[model samples]
Target chain A: MEAAVEMKGISHWFGKVQVIHDVDLSVEKGEIFGLLGPSGSGKTTLVKMMTGLLRPSKGVVQLNGEKMPSLKQLRQFGFMAQSDALYSELTGRENLDFFASLYGMSRKDRHLRMNHVLDMVDLTAYASRPVNTYSGGMKRRLSLAASLIHEPELIILDEPTVGIDPVLRQSIWSELNRLRNHGVTIIVTTHVMDEAEKCGHLALLRDGRMMAEDIPSQLKSKLGVSSIEEVFLHYGGGARA
Target chain B: MNTAAVVKRILKQFHRDKRSVALMVAAPLLVLTLMWLVLDTETSAVKLAAVDVPAQVVESIETEGITVTVMDEAEAEEKLNEAEIGGVLQWEDGAPFVILEGSDPNTSGTIRSTLQKQLSEQNASMEWEYWNGSSELGLFDYVGPALIGFFVFFFVFIVGGVSFLRERTQGTLERLLASPVRRSEIVFGYLGGFGLFTVVQSIIIAAYSIYVLDVFMAGNFLYVLLVTILMALTALSLGTLVSTFAGNEFQMIQFIPLVIVPQVFFSGLFPTEGLAEWVQVVGNLMPLTYGAEALRDIMLRGSSFESFQVEVYILLGFTTLFTVLNIAALKKHRPL
Candidate 1:
């Protein structure tokens, strides 16, 4: 079986500056895979390549054994960018309904899935309110809900829980766990260490290079550290054992 | 397919953002109304010095509403130098000799035309025979169609550009790409959605100008409507396509002078007879040029549908070109 997503010798450049260096990655199905890096570390660029939102300067990005940036394969994934992408002029339900139709969901399924996702994000009460009236945390939750509206098999989330409250963040992660249980493969990029620990497998990236990739506990054991932060700090510092 | 969803979302957004919708409709209407009012009020009386002219001539000119003053030649010259009177009209050996002050073109034009009408009417020597449009056609009648084309293009371009730019800044465009929707669908969706809105806007603006402002109309009303709608669609596509290059809302607005304002200069607003050959060629590249020309042909000249087919094809060609480019530009965000 094909890995959920694969990147081989991937390199990207914007003008003279290189944003993502040669990197190889393979993400399996039913896994909560985390890409951890600081700002400007190229995590966003790397993840964008996987979605076919960007083409690598050199190399291939494949999802489910298909060459990526393919329109047919694009239907299989959901995306939440680093910014809250909701249309402030639109109501939460209307925004969700719009995306639902883009995904070719039937009207009945849209009505059903909209309710489910709104409930998942706990935004049912504010469904009718314009998104501009939504608080920062509420907007984040709404964006999360929109991504899951199509029930995509592979979901790519970039900094999904930044401004979310702790309680909401916990619920969102728990929901991610539930999706994973149902065989949904998730690729998430974040600088938050706590969010990193929730991932089943982690790739520690620094300066566009994949510093390390392993299960969280295995990385911790190898580094002889209690926390993923220490492992990141050490590897990010280029102190390889 | 998914274009309908985009259209639906845009309509809903328009409903939510009532202020923008109002700005799109009302701003143009207000400006057009002001222009018509100004055109109507162009009958402002011109001050002229009547010298060596018989009292009968002065009385006939006065009856036509020109303010005439009794003065000698040197006194009239002094008043003309002082910018007091627009012109001096005198009779010399049965022929009329008129010395115009001629500083202000608008006032000068009024004085000359008023003098001509008075002379023609009082002596009954000239027959005013209009070939196409009547002698009743006002300046507003000539410019009104171009103004309609311009404002429709201006408003729709800004709104369309800004709305599409917001999609990128707000990140919604990235989300759309990740879905099953194709890049072309996004462009078509925007075109369809905003296209419908502009159609209503064109009708309201054109009707208000023709009926309420009483601008001269020689051709079919539906043809004017057709030209305005086509012009708006061209603007819609160009604006959305240009927005892909903009990094923010302000950048999109910056394109107004560079992209839109130039179209007005070449849109038959001013007479291009004295313009450079290259300058006219540049105007030909602007979609508004075709639209404005088509409007002028239909509204002023009462030309046949064949006269407008060139402009119609050019506008549609521009629409198709911009839409194709926009779909390609979106690949910068999502390659598929």
Candidate 2:
């Protein structure tokens, strides 16, 4: 019932060019929420603001009722950037272990959590191989595994399934469902209409503005559309801004 | 515990990158060996032109490694003016009057000493006078320690700066920032990681220069190691600090002229006394000046710990300041 992340009238700019302008979003606890938009639609900027990685030019962001960019609230959120930022020179397991330790995990907890995430991502067999040796999909899975290593209450993933195969994408979606069932709140940013439909709730973004926010099915029914894609087209004008 | 993780991560990365390991070990040695060969070649023959000297004096000069050429006074003066002759000898009041070309003090001193020694053997009553004091040290000895400092500073600064910058531009830095780690922890992580490798680098380079290259080592080996390690720390901190301003490897390399090269000129490698007073003062502000001065004093002058305490502290201050600034710089990445 409680909102996991809330942004009120948030506006951001890179130099003079505005990226996110007077936007409002709320992600509820224990739900899979997606911010659906094409690349350069300010999805990343909005996610960064939600995770407290960037300061808003105007207005406020709150995480679990605590004012953000608070370090305390930041500690409670796990973020996976759009880029697969794993250390290429380090093995997948080593990368996971390093990030886990950064969150001050005890040795026993880190060991258990690392093995859990490796299994969750189905990367247990390749855990010892360096990340540079991983194929594109494997690296993406490993990066996702790393973001989930600490098992934080809220996880923010930016374009997480961009390069993954359909079968692997299905498995990742199932895993997100499983995490949600365990009361974890997730914020996923993607332009894939099918993925947008998978989220329990969706915030459709365009031109740095929130076009609509509701359950995906409800949004489609309200827009009198057969699919989430048509609803996005209705709001996005089906073309470049 | 965080420190242990940092050290382990760095060591693991170092082990994986074997080519960089080889470069860290071999590059300095290769350059140093070439310098040794170039600086240790045999001395060249001293050429002399004597005018109106007795045959006995000419024979004496010839005995002491001088190639003597007999010419009239006019011709001798002409040769001296042309710098084709090292010295000119003419007899006045029953004694030899020496007129020496004064460029290149080493050659001038060598000629004067060779001629005076020859004259003394010919007659024990021959009086000797030097054109200048013999207290000045050799040119090689003066610049040798500074060169050691310069190379160490240069190579380490460049390699460390570009590598750290790569970590950022490649997105690894952003990954680290996203973790729950404090910014200071990341700064210390880099310092500890690079510090371990540089310690070994410093040891190998300093030991090679001292024992193999046979550079002057008037002070204790431990002191030399201490100074070198301190110099390396300053370079490491400075490199990482400056890396924040650079967006990529090329931009990082561009900083060498603006940041690293001027330090060498001010590092006492060349005589800065002839420079304007303000220019000399600018040299004093450089970290390399203190590092090179301390290194040379320990290696050449046999200075004790007490003598170099001020320089040691200044280097420590620079490293600390740069490291703190580096942590502050990371705020640009993650404000938290």
Candidate 3:
């Protein structure tokens, strides 16, 4: 299988303070890769670098063997930032159409894509409502649908399901699995232990360092732990030791 | 103790953010000082041309501490027409016939009064003649063009800066940076979008100033539109450029005293004669200075397009420079 995303010796700094130390990671094509860490463990920073929103201080990020942040490569990925990033003044359909135009989609394609994504996120009924009137969960769902409107080959989601209810979260995860089955790569960053278990592979980060990277079950068995939480605490505590 | 805690927090924030503190306090003070200096400058003596005057009349006119240029009758008429001489005193039937350069009422009035006093003292019976087939206008007429330019610059700067700053504060700017769109495209898009509104705004403001307010208008209306549009573009670009430094809407408002106010002071709203050379240079650098000068030429003096070409070019240069700088400033958000 080909690697869909690659970061080699990636490190980032804000001013003089290092936020993401030298790190290497990759996501295989058609697989869901999860980066699990507590808040401030550099998950957002790392994801930002991969999405080309930020340039790493010392490393190269490539998508499909082409350098990332290349305008050409940016067209291949969808991004859902931690913040909703929706235009509050515009209606849900308008926001989707505006973003779709930016991707150079035809008018007909934009309409079809908007309907499809709106239905997929269960926001079809609220398509005409202004986003400022949306509840937090609905806004999150709209943001998710926006990321998928372009039907990018890779989707980078930063805490995509943070405020979602458990049932909705399950549906979102299942949707991710369905997209993966269609040969889409997904990179999700979350601190929730249960969410980590659903990824095909996981990178557990602590204090800006990777504590462990393996399949969820292998990471559990290697530490002789029954649950992913114990596996995290064991590796996290061992790093402190 | 609560008051003390609040005061301490305010002081700490000021110390941490020196740029905001400096702009808030220093910008206004600096502009105010410049205004004081410009307004307080001494008035220079008015220059007049004496045409075919008797020696006694010329001597009497020269006694009033005014500068007199002796010329032939035709030369004096030409000088008055060109606005080079404030007024011309020519002998008609052994009496004084006065022709005044009537564009600026203050200058024309000074010349008329000075000549009238000199002719009375000389015991010469004189009849005054009117030029341009009309009486002198009010001071408001002379300054109306500058006022129009100043208000457009003032309002557009505040509104554009605040809106852009709000976008930054609301996190929409970051979202824009995350897309595949180039930074230059965003800046150009803003220019294109806002340019549409400003066109209508300039037309309304210019029309109101000309037709409703009854301000002086001697040049073509289309020329006024050209100058107003250029002025609006300059303000728009500067507003967006400065928005990069402002963290919020309030901070954007703070720029009025720093950026917008100084332009008014130097925009020929007030006389800059006898001001310090450096003070005059500062006004020369401001975009509104050229705009106001060009507008006054078109509306008050009925100047032709050739007369305003330089100012038009300078205003366009200012807009282009500010737009490029604004695009560069966005690099702080996204390197590419």
Name the best candidate (by DockQ). 1
Superior by lDDT: candidate 1 or candidate 3: 1
Give the per-residue lDDT digits (tens) of candidate 3, residues B1-336.
222222232333334444544443344334433433443222345677887888876777688766788988788877766566667877777777888776666667777777766667655576766553246466667777887777677666766676567667866566666667787877776666556556766787777677866777889999998998888889879999999998778888788889888887888766664479999999899999999999987887788999899999999999999999998999887778
For candidate 1, what is the TM-score? 0.86
lDDT of 3 at A140: 88
Q: Tell me the lDDT of model 1 at B4.
A: 91
Count steric clashes of candidate 3. Answer: 0
Instruction: Give the poorly placed runs of model 3, Cα more than 4 Å off.
Output: A165-168, A238-241, B1-101, B113-119, B123-136
Give each prediction's DockQ, rounded to 2 decimals: 0.71, 0.55, 0.18
Give the top-scoring candidate (TM-score): 1
**Of 1 and 2, the candidate ranking higher by lDDT:** 1
Q: Name the weakest run of 10 consecutive residues (lDDT summed) in model 2 chain B.
A: B128-137
User: Lowest-lDDT window of 10 residues in candidate 1 chain B?
Assistant: B123-132
All-Cα superposition RMSD per candidate: 8.7, 8.6, 9.4
Per-candidate Cα lDDT values, in order, are 0.86, 0.81, 0.79
Per-residue lDDT tens digits for candidate 1, residues A32-82, read 999999998999898889888889999999999999888888889989988
